[model samples]
Target: MNWLILVIAGLFEVGFTTCLKLSDNFTNFKWSAGFFICISLSFYLLNKAIQTIPLGTAYAVWTGIGAVGTVLMGIFFYKEPSDFLRLLFIFLLIGSIIGLKIVSE
Candidate 1:
């Protein structure tokens, strides 16, 4: 259902952020188009999700997914640091997202 849709939207948020990174300040045409497409789908699905889910809860989950995903993408794809504290916080964020899902239910 709607929770699934919300999760998909959150994943699209991930996709858009990755695309944004690859866009290279709009210098890359394909990535730029991907960014726009992903973001649009993300928002559209978010809106659909919010028809049942509370706005604050949905937004929080959405951004949480985006933040965690972007950080992971940075580490895996861009050679960004994955120091102890950074990883710990990422795990914490993931736990919080899960908590929100439980509480929302």
Candidate 2:
């Protein structure tokens, strides 16, 4: 469904962002390619989802998922900081995303 596509798009957003970092300013060819491909696909799917979902809701959810996933990826793979306040805000972002979905329905 559209929601599934939106979720996949959001996941692709995370992937593209991570690949962007790994690309090292586009110096790494493989990661850079991945970054471009994932971003294209993410946007394509997001555009598809917006046909049904409200623009504001879809955009917020998309960015929320991307932000949360990217932060988790940074924490786990890149060994970035994982402090309490950081986690609290991540959860709050999640809550806001969920709230958007609920109110949208």
Candidate 3:
């Protein structure tokens, strides 16, 4: 389904963000390559998804997924701060994503 593809694309967005951090200004060949690959795939999939889905909806969902995923990844792997307010906002973002999914055609 298109929704599934969109979700996958959003996941790749997370991957690209992680690789971007690991790339160290693109000085690291492996992570830089990973960043390019993930970003390319993410864009390709997003293009595919937007063919049918509304642009605003797809964009919002895509960025929402990326934001939530990146935050979680930073918290878990990079030992980023995980304060209550941050977590609360993440949960709110998640709920908004889900609501968008439910309301979208």
lDDT tens digits, residue span 43-96, model 3: 999999999999899999999999999999999999999999999999999999
Which lDDT tens digits does candidate 2 get at residues 47-99? 99999999999999999999999999999999999999999999999999899
Tens-place lDDT per residue, model 1, 4-79, is: 9989999999999999889999899999999999999999999999999999999999999989998999999999
Decide which is better by lDDT, 1 or 2.
Answer: 2
- Residue 24 lDDT in model 2? 97
TM-score of each: 0.96, 0.97, 0.99
- Prediction 3 global C-alpha lDDT: 0.97
Candidate 1 stretches greater than 4 Å from native = none
Using TM-score as the measure, which candidate wins?
Answer: 3
Between candidates 2 and 3, the one scoring higher on lDDT is 3
| Model 2, TM vs. native | 0.97
Residue-pair clashes per candidate:
0, 0, 0
Point out where model 2 deviates above 4 Å: none
